[model samples]
Target: MTASPNRGLALTVGAILAIWGILGFFFAGEGGHAFFGNEGGYLWGVFLVNPALCLVWTLLAAAMLIGGLGTTIGSRNLNLLAGVVLLVLALYGLLFMNTSANVFALNAVDNGFNAIVGFVLLLTALAADRENLRALRADRDDLDALRAEAAHG
Candidate 1:
């Protein structure tokens, strides 16, 4: 029942992504070029800070945050899946930087950032799962030891 260390990592990452996505819209401006570059196009400088990309990031953030809150196997599985999907999307963006084939305003900088973020999420999820398993095994061992002591005494 203890929370995984990676749960904090997930929450942090999710909050950051969610905040960035939300702030992106405000800074986008009417011309869609307030913070770094313009929007409404497939590519913009080295960032794909479009509304669609923002929305996607926000949703992903939400999923990660929510998944991190639960201590169930299902929640962990969902987190793993989300991490994989994020990594795939980042890889796709990197592979097709010049094209808008995936409907994402991808660029080397943004995609590279995405890749790092995704990698972190994936690594954290794996670590969390491993920790959870270790905890379970320890619990079982403790129970076994207790039962043995009870039987002997």
Candidate 2:
């Protein structure tokens, strides 16, 4: 069977997010710093990199990867929804980076990263949808052409 247009990209993004989340836990205990820099008691520079965030990332990653791999209608819808959710989260991070209630410790760096990832996911989903539509249209056109040829011959 033909692979989905965004399957490879979704898999790569899922793997990266999963690995990053897992690595965040490495410094979960006391004295743990953010992965890139010390921020919010995390080894990384992002906001509080705790077990909870790691779990969230892992779950999101699993959803994206699994949905991309599956051929069911539910899976395709899941993939699209995941992309939309990521975009929304990124927008939230960027818009509330300096708010007092910003408990996620999302700084400019983290927000930027989130925005980039979200954009990538959104683009991949749109591209995939476009490709599928194009393929369907091509198939329809080919069928029509064949019918015409047979009728005239």
Candidate 3:
């Protein structure tokens, strides 16, 4: 029942994204914008988003929330996974920011934000839970030694 920093981060990010995702629908398609169009309105006058992006955000948020509410290991793993995915998505979005391939309606701001969040998640997952990591490593080492002794015997 150890509390993970990743859990806190996941919960906070998940909640914020959930709220943004819901509000995003209201401003998604402004003036006949396509569902996956490059053109989109800003969420809270900051992050550019469309229906597709909102859906993606909502899905990610759900995952984060669920992970946060689960075991510490679950949160850490989820953060790692989500961070990698977000980083890749951010790179893709940045590359196709102004193209028709930008189905998520991602802009520079969104890409930047995604990159930042991704990095944060990744770093936290790798750096946090030191005690658990040490214990796990120690357990593995002990297991290895036991196995070696059993094989020799």
TM-score for each predicted model, relative to the true structure: 0.69, 0.66, 0.84
Candidate 1 RMSD to the real structure: 6.1
Give one digit per residue, the lDDT tens place, for model 3 in 1-153. Answer: 336798898898788778878888888977767888888888878888999888888898999999999867789899999899889989999899989999988988889888998899999999998787678679889999999999999
* Candidates' C-alpha lDDT: 0.66, 0.64, 0.87
- Which model is ahead, 1 or 3, in terms of lDDT? 3
Quantify how close model 3 is to the true structure by its C-alpha RMSD in Å.
3.2
Compare the candidates by lDDT and give the number of the best one: 3
In model 1, state the lDDT of residue 104: 58
* Candidate 2 C-alpha lDDT tens digits along 41-134: 4546554554545566678788867866765343446656766776776677667666754445556665666677777776766656666667
How accurate locally is residue 59 in candidate 2, as Cα lDDT from 0 to 100? 81
Which number leads on TM-score? 3
Clashing pairs in 3: none
> Any idea how many clashes model 3 has?
0
Candidate with the larger TM-score of 2 and 3: 3
- Identify the runs in model 3 with alpha carbons over 4 angstroms from their true place: 136-153
lDDT of 1 by residue, 51-143 (tens): 767777788788767866865454556556766877887887777656546455556776777788778767766766686767877998999
Q: What are the clash counts of all predictions, listed in order? A: 0, 7, 0
